[model samples]
Target: MSRRNHTDKNASGDPRKRTGAPGVSAENGDGGYNAGIAVFSYIVGGIIVWSLIGWGLDYLWGTRWIVLVGALLGAAGGFYLSHMHGLTSSRNPAGGSGAASGPSEDGNSNAK
Candidate 1:
């Protein structure tokens, strides 16, 4: 009467034991609220500050187009900054370049 180990490797070779939960994987477990919340806050705050600056500039220059341009630029810059910050933070802390290492469908890195 020996108990079978369900966690033992299956015929396909993958471990039968679950990692995190049913659907949750290792990648999804990392970076909880700090990633999404912090990035969102920074972007929103930056946009607000930029909008204020744009309004001031329009007031001083007496041109509405300047404010519009500023708003657009601010949005773009904020989005870019947020994306970069997320990318950097998601990387390895040991300065290991943190590039994702996995097999590609086309057998090349450029295959997307």
Candidate 2:
């Protein structure tokens, strides 16, 4: 008369379990949120880091306008990096599909 703890480790000591509901999409998954956060962090981090560098340069050179340029350059670089990453991921065929890729006769995919 004891209840089974399905959430805990199974008999074989394997932690993987497929007990959850299926048919979940990436838009509703954590992947999209994580990607967004990564992009945002890149942009923010670039701006902050470059602005600090520019401030240091200005302090050393006794200039007052290089900080703005540095900030703008940092933002542009961040945007470019994010855009490239987005493009690369979008171009990947396995990106949109949440399935394991298999080998094809035509040898188009690297999957085995």
Candidate 3:
């Protein structure tokens, strides 16, 4: 295969007039490495945040069980959060109406 020239020009003679990236869209697809990492972070982050809170409470109250409680709470919270915003969610990740949005109130189907 031949290499593309670095200074390739478009019909308008502007090399910088490029559109979106070939395959790198801002939209999120279902079930991939991104989803996996997001879910993992949700669970692990929950555990760490809750555990630290629990530990702080335990230290302040001179007790040894608050940390455990915090950890449990964190785990539960994280799981809940992940579930609500996980890959299986029906809601759009981009915060738009849903799917293609199917036209807007201005009545312009082709308007961005």
Candidate 4:
């Protein structure tokens, strides 16, 4: 029932303390935490905003199914956004599995 100071040494007493996610450390000042929050916002915000829009449409037009469609669309959009931003492989894609890595008119390529 007591508050724990995450900035200080944890209960485990390990000097090199870590947080909820692997390789993420608030003490280390990494942006991983911010990135996690942004991803979550994308998913939840999409659902909430789209659902409200769907509700409005359903009310104005006297329909009962557009809500489902809007919800599904929001989920898909959210997932797409989350995948594009949250997933490291999709962001960097140094494995040559991503778009824009190929040579373009500017001769930009993932040479490394």
Tens-place lDDT per residue, model 2, 31-71, is 35566666677678789889999999999999999898889
Find the candidate with the highest TM-score and give its number: 3
Q: Rate the local accuracy (lDDT) of all candidates.
A: 0.60, 0.63, 0.66, 0.64
Candidate 2 Cα errors over 4 Å, as ranges = 1-31, 87-112
Q: Write the per-residue lDDT of candidate 4 for residues 1-112, one digit (tens) a residue.
A: 9876656564576646543333334443333666577566767878888888999999999999888888888877877876654332233325555567545775546455
**Model 1 per-residue lDDT tens digits across residues 1-112:** 9776654443455666433322223354344555566556666767777888889998998878766666677777767866654422454546655666677456775764
Clash pairs, candidate 1, are none
TM-score of every model versus the real structure: 0.46, 0.51, 0.52, 0.47
Report the poorest 10 consecutive residues by lDDT, candidate 1: 17-26
Worst lDDT run of 10 residues, candidate 4, spans 85-94
> Which ranges in model 3 have alpha carbons more than 4 Å from their true place?
1-28, 88-112
The parts of candidate 4 lying over 4 Å away from their true place are: 1-31, 86-112
TM-score comparison, 1 vs 3, better candidate: 3
